[model samples]
Target: MKKPTLRLRLLRSFLVILTPLVLFLYYENYYAIKIVREEVSQSTSNVLSIHITQIDRTLDEITHYLLQQIVTSDTKSAYLDMASLPETNGNYTLAKIKIHNELTSGSTAFENFHSFFAYSVKKEDFIFSRSSFTDTNDLKEMLGEYVREKVKGQSFSDWIVLRYWEKSYLVRVAQASDGVYIGAVLLLEDLIRPLRGLDYGDRWEAILLDTTGQPLTKSVMSPETMTAVNRKLVTNPLAFQVFENPADHKDYLLVSTDFKQAPLRLAAMIPEKSLLQRLPFFQGVIYLIPLGVIVIFIFYSHYLRKMLFSPMNSLIMGMRRVVKGDMEIGLKEAETEELNFLITTFNHMVSQISHLKINVYEEMLKAQQSEFKHLQAQINPHFYLNSLNIINSLSTLGENDLIKKMTEHLADYFRFITRSHRDTITIDEEVRHIRNYLEIQMLRFPEKITYNIDLPEPFSRTMILPLMIQPFVENAVIHGMEEGSKPFHIEISAGNCQEDPNCLEILIRDNGVGFTPEVLSTFNQKKFGDGTGTHMGIWNVYRRMRMAFGYQAEVTFLLGEPNGAIVRLTIPAIGAFHEMEEEEDGKADDR
Candidate 1:
C-alpha cells in the first residue's frame, strides 16, 4: 500500500480529534438547553405564584368586607325589624329606608363593590341602596338568575363569579336572618386589579380562568394558543407545563395556580423563545457555541500545520535530499524544542559526513605519495649500479670524448634522483631525466640499444609524480632485452588523452620479450607484491598511480604485436605552473 501524503495524514488526525470534540460539544449544548429550560420553567412558576397570591389576597379582602357587612348590628337590626313589621304599616317603610341607608353606607366604604342588596322573605320585597349603578329591578333579576344557576343549592356565604349585563362580578350569598338573604356584587376587574401590577414581558400573558377552563378576563394569548392550552389542561393539567404552540410551532411555558378564595385559576403563558431572550447570558452561549467551535478548529489546524505538519514535511524533504547525496541541504530552526533538536542533529550529521569525506581523500593521497617515494627510493640504487657499470666499461675503452659525455649524463641522472624532496616533476623534466638514463645505456651498448622520444610541447608542462613513467620504461628495457635477438628499440611518446582532456597519456613500447601470463594476471588483479623483483617496478608504479589519482589514472602492460612489451599510462594533466603557485602560497602561509 502507498503511504498517505502529509496533508492526508494531518486531515485524518484532525478528524480523529474533531469527531469526539464535536460530539462532546453537541452533548454539552443539549444539556445546557435542557437546564436553561428547566430554570425558565421554575422562574415562570414563581412569578405565577406571586400573581396568584396577590389575587387571593384581594379576594380575601373582598370576602372580609362582605362578612363585616353581614354581621354588623345595623344589618341584623334591619333584618329583625323587616321580619316583625306588618305589610301595611308605615314603620315597615321606615325600616326598609333604614336598611337601604345601612347597605348604601356599607357599599360606599368598599371601592370594589358595585352595589349591595338585601331580600326579605316575609315582606316579599327586595331592598337595595339607591346609590347602586343599575336599576333595582335589574339588580334583583341578575341576583335571582345567579342564585338559580350557581348559588341555589350552595351553602350560605358561598362566593360565585357570574356575569351581569355584559360584565363579570363576584357575588356572595348569605342568610342575614332566618328568612332574609343578603348578596354583594364586586366587579371581577376589581378582583384582578392586583395582577395588573405584574411585569410579564410582551410575549407573555396572564389570564384568569374559571374551573370550567373558560377565560374570565382578557388574555394576550392568541385564540389558537388558548385552545391548545385548554385542550392540554384536560389531561395534563399540571401547575407548570411546557408545550409547543400548534398554531406557530413555538414553545410556550405555562404556570398555573388556583385562587383559594375563588373558583379561578391564574395562569401565566410565556414563549420559550422569549424566556431564552430574557437571559442575555444564555442567548450569548447559544450564539457563541458554533462560533466557538469554528474558532477552535481554525486555531487548532493552524497550530498543527505550523508546529507539527510543516516542520515534519521540511524534515522529510531534507532527508530525501540527503539520501540523494545532497549533504549541503539543511533544515531551518523549529519552534518546538523536540523539532529543533532533530534539526540540530541532522545538520551536525551532514557536517560530519562532509568532513569525513575530505579526511578520507587526504589520507589516501598521503599513503599513495608515501608509497611512491619509497618505491622510487628503491629503484634509485639499481639504476645507479647499472650506470656505474656502463661508465666503468666506457673508461676501459679509452674513448675520452664518450667517457666525458657519459660521465656528464650519469651525473645529471643521479642529481635528478637525489632530489627526494620533490614528489612531482614536470613532464619535460621527467623526459629529460629518462633520456639521460637511456643515453648512458646506449653508450654501454651503442648499437644494441636505440630509442626515440616523441613528447609534444603542449604536454611538456603537465605535472605528475616523479618516476611514475620512468619505472615502466626501466621495466620494458630490462624485460624486453631477454628475448630479442634484434637490436632493442624503445619508443616513448606522450599526448593528451582523447577521453579526458585533463589527463596526459604516455605510451612506451620496446621490441623485446613481453610479460608472462602469471605477471599479467597479477597486474589485472591489482595485487602489487609478486615475490619476484622483475614485476616490482611495474607493480609499484601501478599501485602509486591508483592511490594518487584514483580512477582518473589508467595503466596497462601488454605485448605489442608479436615481439615487444608495451606499457601505456595516463595521469591528470595538472599544470606545473599552478602547482608551483600553490606551493608558494603554502610556503607564505608557513612563514
Candidate 2:
C-alpha cells in the first residue's frame, strides 16, 4: 500500500476534528434545552410554592385569631347577645370593651366589624354582634352536628352569614362550655383581601374552604370544581393534593399545611404554565455561544496555560500556606496586580471579622444585663402592692374568713403574676380571683357593701388573664360606691354575650352617689394624673392588659341600673380552656 501525502494527512486530520465539533454542537443544544426546561420548571414551582405558602399563612393567622376569641368566655357571652339572645345578654356589656381592645391591639383584622354571633344548638336563633363576633342559636344548631363528628377538643372553620352586612365571614368554632359554643367571625373580605393584594395573577386565584370543601369566601369558583376539590379534601382531609385546573384545563399544584399546635388549615395552588414560560428563552441563550467557534482559541489556550493557569496555581498554594498559619508566603508578581491585592485583603478581612465577633459577644452580654434590670423593675411595683395588701390585712384583722378570702385573693393574684408562664388563663380562675378580692373588701366594710356573685356554670376554665376581672371589681368597690347611709350593691355575673363569647358582667350600684361625666372622662385617660396614690391598681391593670393581651382586655365604667356605676371586664376565652370551669364547679360544690 502507498503512503498518504502530507496534504491528504492534513485533510484527514481536519475531517476528524470537524466530526467531533459537529457532534458537540448538536449535543450541547440538546442538553442546553433540557437544562433550561428543568430550570423553568423549578422556577415556576418555587413561585407557586411561595404563593401557596402565603395563602396557607393567611388562613393560619385568621384561624389562630378566631379560635383564640371563641375559646374565651367573655367573647362567648358577647356572641349570645348579638343574636338577640337573653341567656347572657346582661353580661354582654363588656363585649364592646373587648372588641375595641382587640381592634386597637391589632388582634382582629377588620375595622368596621358589625357583629359576632353564633347559632343556638337548637338552630332556633342566630346569636351574633359587631365586636368579638359570637352567636348562640346558629352555633348551637350547626356546631352541634360538628362536635358529634369532630373530636371534642378540636376546632373547625366554616362560612357564616352576618345579619348587619350583605357579606359572609370565615367563622371558627370550638366547645367553650357545655350547651354554649364559642366562635369568632372574620369578615370574608378581610381574609381574602390580603390574598388579593398578592401579585398572584388572574390565573392564580386562591380558594379558602372547610374540610368539606364549602367556599368560605365569595370568590367566584365553578360549582363542579368546588365540589370536586371538597370531595378530594374530605377523602384525605389532612394531606395536600394537586389536580388539573378545572377553569383552564391546565395542571396546577396544590398543597396544605397544618399549623403546628394551632387550630388552622392552610391550602394553596399554582398553575404549571407559569413555570414553563422561561424555558425557551434560556434555551436560545445557552446555544448561542460555542466554546470552539473562535479562530483565536489555540492562541488564547497558550496564554491561559502559561500565564493564567500557573499564577492561579501559585495563588491557591499561597492560600493553603496561609491556612496552615504561614501568612508570610510570597507570590510571584503577575500582570494582574489586583489578584495580589485580593490575597492581602483576605488576610485583613479575617482579622477584622474575628475582632467584630468579640465585640458583638461583649455587647450581647451587656444587653442581657440591661434586659434583666428592666424585668426586675417591672415586677417591683406589683410585688410592693401585693406586700402592702398583705400587711394591711394581717395588721388590721388577723385570721378571719374575710381575711382568709382576701389573703387567698392576693395569693391567687400573685400566683398569676409569677406564672407569667402564659399570656392568658381560664376565665374561671380569673373570676375566682376577682371574687376573692371582693370578699376581702366586703370584710373591710362588712355591713356597708353587699356583694353578689352570678357567674354561669362551667365558664371557669375558658382562657382569660387571672386578674382581668379584679381590676374592674376594685374600681367599682373603691371608686364607684361611697361609704354612706345608703347601701352599696356590687353584682358580678358571667353570662353568654349575645354576639361575643362569655362576658363577666359586673354592676356596682350605690344609692350614695353616681359618677358624673367628668369622673368618667378622667377615668378613661390612659395615665391617671395623680399616680401618687390614685388609680394605681386601675392604671397598672389597664397598661399591663394592653401590653399582655393587647387591647382586647380593658376596664370600662358606665352608669349602672337602679343607680351607681357598672364596671365591665371583658376578656378573650379559649374554647378548650375547661380547667377553670371544673375548678369553679368544685368551689360551688364546697359551698
* Backbone Cα, N, C clashes tallied per candidate: 0, 73
Reference-based lDDT, residue 246, model 2 = 70
lDDT (Cα, tens digit) per residue for candidate 1, span 438-486? 8767766768888999988877766676777777777666667863357
Off by over 4 Å in 2: 1-422, 499-512, 525-533, 549-554, 572-591
RMSD of each: 13.1, 52.5
Per-model TM against the reference: 0.49, 0.31
Task: Give the number of the best model, judged by TM-score.
Answer: 1
Instruction: Supply the global lDDT for candidate 2.
Output: 0.55
CA lDDT, candidate 1, residue 104: 85
Tens digits of per-residue lDDT for model 2, 53-73: 664565565556666666567
Candidate 1 lDDT trough over 10 residues, lowest sum: 145-154
Q: Compare the candidates by lDDT and give the number of the best one.
A: 1
Kindly report which residue pairs in candidate 1 clash with one another. none
Q: Residue 112 error for model 2, in Å?
A: 99
